[model samples]
Target: MNQNLPCTEPRPIPAAKKVTRRRSPISLIWIVPLVAVLIGIGLAVSAILQRGPEIELQFASGDGLDVHKTKLKYKEVAIGTVTAIALSEDHHSVKVSVQMDKRAAPLLAGDSRFWVVRPRVAAGGVSGLNTLLSGAYIALDPGKSRNVKRAFVGLESPPLVIGDMPGRQFVLGADDLGSLDVGAPVYYRHIPVGRVVGYVMRPDGKGVDVRIFVDEPYDHFVTTATRFWHASGIDLSVGADGMKLEMQSLLSVVAGGVAFGGGDASNGEAPVASRFTLFSDQTTALRQPDSIVQKYVLVFNESVRGLTVGAPVDFRGISAGEVSRIDIDFNRRASDVAMAVEISLYPERFARQQRNRPTALPTQQGLRQILDGMVAKGFRGQLRTGNLLTGQRYVALDFFPKAKAAPIGWNRPIPELPTQPGSLDSLQEKLVAVVDTLQGTLQRVDRLIAHVDQEVVPEVAPTLRDARQTLARANAVLSSDAPVQMELRDTLREVERAAASVRDLADTLEQQPQSVLTGKKASK
Candidate 1:
């Protein structure tokens, strides 16, 4: 075992040396985190620097809106997002903050409008139905104004004419709204061509002012001479002329609509903000204007049961005027009640047919003279049954040559026209008179019958009884099964036999005259 002690003396341990490790400025382990932090900082700066502007929207409600989810869109393009929602200072509305993209900043202006789009059914039609499934969203209608805006009041309803819809607005003066509503259709020749935008009660509260917009090409049809009327429902009229039914369209019947048309004369294009009158119906709207109207009152001592406002005042079956007002007044002086009927005569309507018309438009002296002459000739106004079914009556003017003469009163504000009982009234009077005469005659006949029953009937009673007995006996003799009838039948048979015998004798004489003289001639 060569385990002999080798050089057991360990060499001197190497002296300790200073080893200074070169220190790198940055450690490789930290490099990754540093780069990461730097990238994060850069992204944050970009988000702050490139951010868009923010605006506030005031809405009556916060319905169907979600923070960070609701979006504002224009032409179906998303442009902004709802960031915050809070109640307004007055607690009357919900104020929403929207962060709009820088690209959409240019579209924000004072006149820009915003509204929540949802399923809505209006008179015009159903709209915003697509929003039912996709959820309600804010809709933006960019304005033409250039003024910048930071806050805006949201619209409760979507605009009827959104964006730059090519149209022109017109004003209509109406006695009342009459079923008209915003977004109602405007019709031309039964076709929808526009929409009602607004309606306002007049400042004086006397009527309504309706605003409507007509599309570009259809606007051309609206001229100075065009007539506007309510075409809201079916017009069914029955009168002396008979039944008349007029309809515009099925849509117009349900939604309420305005219709326009022109006469042969359509002068020029109506101005941008032109104003027109809204008549009750197409017939009234298109009728020629009555420039010369003369009003007159008629006093009648008889009943005016079937008379009504708008009843036609006919001149020999031709329409000349209409009843305007019917009133009743007490007369303390005469102590008699009478009906006061005010009628308007369109003198110009008849004047158009005259061979010579008045030279000027103002004065009506010539008309007065003509009416005076007519009155002198026994011409007067009378109430007559125009329609038997409806019991409608109308004023009729005709010449009554046999009637008593009456004078016209031309001094009052509304001239007084002489009136006479209607033909029906006269007929009723005649019938009543005839009935009275018949009643008197019947009374006299009744008295005669009573006298006969008391005196003459008693005296003739026995004679009448005897005559009845004789008639009874004659009836008994005439009976089929009586003895007299049987005896008569026997006599008739005997007569027949005798006649036969005479014929036989005559025949024998013709054959042999000698045999007739002979006693008898025996047959074989």
Candidate 2:
């Protein structure tokens, strides 16, 4: 058989030459995008799961806050963002929905604070505006506290113009405007710390009770002995050299602030809570003791002059504390008015550094000895007015401590309060004395007039008749001679001189009565 001849065993027609082809470029394009889409979906799921927890906050007003756009921050770091905001079912407040990061979850404790901050125009300067452009965020503070549930009130309520509250809370009520517009300041010192939160009517509708929130640190300054009063507005003060009213802020023209003064302090007590308290942390200030002689109260037989609340309680011209309370004591047998006051001392000035060694503490007898020494001197409590225009009062303790002259029994009948120089009571007494003297002098004048009418007038009448007869004869003679006319002119001139002298004397007496009668120097 020739090689070229085909074998009967079928030459498998070279199985249609199996062809090898490359995948199309277009297919690869679709595959690449599909893989990218899957990765993106996975990333989105992760993001959703990472968001931590959410809570609701109620606010009376949303002044500077916004939903979704606002962010939550902790320690000035953004911790979460607000998701939504809606009105409550009752339409009384705004309910804000917030989502926080998981990392911030543990920090959300029961004592955690939450308050919306906007542009704050305060006595010092404008603040919180950066939060606006930077996006409103929630600020987190991991305060040192034990509780773990987080809840807060959103305050749109302004601060208190006067008075104080014990804890943090929401705005409950407000007062209807009385005759005065309630915009005066609430100050801690000269520094403005808070505002008029609002006002409300008492259940019985007797008077208005104003609510105020002093921000933390400043809030802690208030204690049982703390006093409050209205600063009113700037007053024009005039003196021999100049006149001015120390008005600084135009915004404060209508607005007012509250102030701090006294407290019944404890030793080494720290601030109760640091974050989100209605008032500032006042514990530090309260624990301190005063260096100067501290006065507890000053009473007067009458109203003390220049005594006002928020007035500086001075010891040797240095302010240690302020007057806290004022009330009257009315007893039928009492001769004078009773005033009650409380004072606070500076802590740092009086506190002593503790030694490492343990030693027996002073006994009650030793403490009494110290106190007795303080009381034995003139160092006693008194009252004085801060500003005459405002009539605000303050308490001042005299440095000279005297022995316990009067037992300070709680239930004992309070005696009359001591009066200041030229007090209201003294002035009233002087006025009464002046009136009595004037009455006596008037009675004497009346008697003199009666005598003139009864005796002098009757005698003069007879003399006048005799003169008339003589004058008649003279008239006949005068008709012939001119000498009578000259004599008449001279008589008229003498009468005029006498009248002038009497008028001069009356003017001198009226202008300088003290000089004429009492020989005392008179005020110009």
Candidate 3:
């Protein structure tokens, strides 16, 4: 009965076709779109969380750095990206914020350093041009320290204030542009170590406060006894060596560099302060006149024809140093003009190289002896023209080692150099003396000529005319015949014999003047 009823009830529907059911439109419109949107948002959130924390760094310069466009690199691989850029409160520096990849977090330490890589011009060479085009990056030089919460500074340019570990301190000063101004180099066996710090006028204006720098091992290497001198540029000179000086860079004209070294503490007992100042500018404005003491000396039988205040005080023509100051002394004791020259010599320039050799030789006495011997041994002083147009003069010392040597003492009289006329004054005096003597001699000669023409010539002319007339009359009388000719021949022979005898007598008188004089005196 139930089957019959179902059949009947469905009979009306079975006469048509089977119906297909459709899903809800609301689910297709809202739920599927929601699921896709959720997936995208979840992916974005996960990516952001995985990227990790960002760091902020401050910098004094950003010359080679870029924000967002530049990356932070470690081990030559990019590890972070610059996220933002802003100015610091002081406005003197730039603050850069960097977002590091999560994978790189462990690599960073508290002591990690960040410096800007930029183009640098140095005496050794120039560097960092490739980085300029790529934009400057944060260069991470991780340190050995183990602190977890770390901070770092991003540099825009190289640091003006250099750092050195625990050792000596080389305080360097700089100009506004940060260029160094010094005459010499900080060298280690001719190798460069540091640069000249700019100089300042001392408070009292008596001197300059110079600054220099030394890094680590080199700082320790340059001990208290270290010596500094100008090795910046070529100081060419034409002398025994023909040319002397250093010529390295075109930039040396406006700027200079330094070098250092020799040996460790090889220098004999260092001074208490261990600091020394070197100067190359010899202008009076840069010097303290009273800082140096000069003594009055009487140079008896000695003359400095070519010596000057800046002359090289040489020992055997090898320059030990220069004559710093000079003065003239009126010798009340000896009634002569004396010269006193103060000289400062440096053994360090050469001594540093030979530090390991032996005891430092006594420079004062040894150099004195060498100088004394040189002067006595025909070592002559002469003036040399340094610059023709400027008329700047320098001193030259030449020696003949074979000449006689002289003795020297503490206040010993400087031996006279071989004299040679060089100065304008000396030359003019000689010319005047020569001209005066020549004029006097010419006047005397003219007077003698006039006397001969007016007195001697006239008197001798009348006598000579009379003798010629007498000879002509005698010749006319003797023109007669054979007897005259024979007589003339005999007379000629006698005349010849008399002339020979006169010549012999004159020769005897000339040969034995003393005998002739004695005979003449006796006759008188």
Number of the top TM-score candidate: 1
TM-score of each: 0.79, 0.37, 0.48
Model 2 misplaced stretches (Cα beyond 4 Å)? 1-17, 22-26, 62-67, 120-125, 131-147, 150-152, 157-524
Query: Which residue runs does candidate 3 get wrong by more than 4 Å?
Result: 1-53, 58-67, 87-94, 101-126, 140-156, 159-228, 237-243, 248-255, 264-306, 309-324, 330-338, 342-440, 449-524
How do the residues 1-524 of candidate 1 rate in per-residue lDDT, one tens digit apiece?
Answer: 47875756768999999999999998899999999999999998886676679999999999999999999999899989999999999999999999898788989987999999988888878888998888889999988898999899999988998768898999999999987899889999988999899999999999999999999889988989999999877878877555678878887778788999984334888988899999998878988888778899998888999888998899976789899999985698999899999999997777665678856543578678888898889889999998888878899998888878788888878899999888888999999999999999999999999999999999999999999999999999999999999999999999999999999889888888897568557778
lDDT of 3 at 460: 97
lDDT of 3 by residue, 190-297 (tens): 555555544676676665556665544566676544444444555455332234455434544356554433335665533322555453421211322232222222
lDDT scores in order: 0.89, 0.56, 0.58
lDDT of 2 by residue, 96-189 (tens): 8788887778877665657665666654346578766775554544544567664566545223321234433223122333222333445656
Candidate with the greatest lDDT versus the true structure: 1
lDDT at residue 334 of model 1 (Cα atoms)? 90
